[model samples]
Target: MKKSQDDAKSLQERALRLLARREYSYAELMQRLSRFASKDVVEEVLDHLSEAGYQSDQRFAEVWIRNRLQQYQGEQRIRYELRQKGIARERVDQEILAANPNWPELAAALYRRKYGEMLAPSREEQAKRMRSLLNAGFSYDQVREALKHLDSEAEFD
Candidate 1:
């Protein structure tokens, strides 16, 4: 019995170590830890980590949103991903807008990255670019605002 308890403790510690290296949402932690610990043990360790302030979904969401947006120009795609990661919807929204994302800027940057330039020389090209932006998870308004004399050469960072 004592050996079993010690093993559980060890697993928990290893889980925390992995988490400390980088942020992990609750669901992410479970997915990663399940390999080393039983479902019940994983849950127990998660609960302990939560109570001890070592794990916080709110913080995870906030950091994830900030990092992804800055690194990837993530918009709705990242928002949905965070929800899937078990972050509360409200918290995800709060974190996403915490830095007040420049929607037009992000859209322009993403558009430029996916397409060569905002103003296509031909209507067909413009339409194709528009479709690409939409598929990249940008809203119509965002695409319009971004493409309205948008320049990708301007660095967002």
Candidate 2:
């Protein structure tokens, strides 16, 4: 009984410490806590914390989305990453759609920053640029839109 109480206290403290640094998804917290405590204890602590509002998947998703947006990541990659973090598909879609970022403009801006106003002079170069943008998580439509205006260089000043 004493050992159980100690374990419980330790788990809660560790959890609080982790949460203090930054937000964590439920699965992330559980995986971390499981290293120190039993699965049952981790579940109980997580439930209590969640009920008390210390842990929220919704909040985690919102912040994660904003952070990824600054990195100019596309929706497909963002959705995949959020799912990997244990957010449900419905919630992920809701959060992403709700944010409603202009993906085409974003893609164009990123393309300008990387390749500049110098047009791809050959078919191979155009295909290579397309592949780069696609690998950076853009959809085909967004990449095509970005390609159309490559000559209009962005004014950084």
Candidate 3:
């Protein structure tokens, strides 16, 4: 019993260390700590932390969304990332819809950063780039709109 208790404490401490470095969704923390704990202990510690105000899904979601936006990742990418972290799809969508990120502006900024002062690629090239952008988490319409502006002028003020 003592060994079990110590192990649980250690997992909590390690989870805290990780959280201090960066916000993590409750599910994410559990997944990471579960390597060191049983499923039941992981759930108990998570519940304790949550009740003590040390863990929060909404706060985690907010910070995750903010970081992704800063990195120019669109809602599609952010949602996918959150799901991969074990956050519910509904929660991810709720946060993304609430965010309503400016994909057009973000895509434009990313395009400019990567390919400044160069002509937009040919339609075939642009299509490939578009696919890459989509894979990077942008929507089809957002890519089209951003590329339209980019193709219009190699040098945008």
Which candidate tops lDDT? Answer: 2
User: lDDT by residue for model 3 over 72-91, one digit each (tens)?
Assistant: 78768888888888788888
TM per candidate comes to: 0.81, 0.90, 0.84
The reply for model 2, stretches above 4 Å from the true place, is 149-157
Which 10 consecutive positions of candidate 1 have the poorest summed lDDT?
A: 148-157
Candidate 1 structure quality by residue, lDDT tens digits, 1-157: 7976886898788877987798888888898888876898888888999898899998898788777766544477778889889888888878877868887788787776766553677989888887777766667888888887474344342
Give candidate 2's whole-model lDDT.
0.86
Which ranking of candidates, highest TM-score first?
2, 3, 1
Question: lDDT (0-100) at residue 129 of candidate 3?
Answer: 70
Number of the candidate with higher lDDT, 1 or 3: 3
Candidate No. with top TM-score: 2
Residue 149 of candidate 2: its Cα lDDT?
57
Which lDDT value does model 3 have at 134? Answer: 83
Candidate ranking under lDDT, highest first, comes to 2, 3, 1
Question: Cα-based RMSD of the predictions, in order?
Answer: 4.0, 2.7, 2.4
Error of 1 at 144 (Å): 1.5
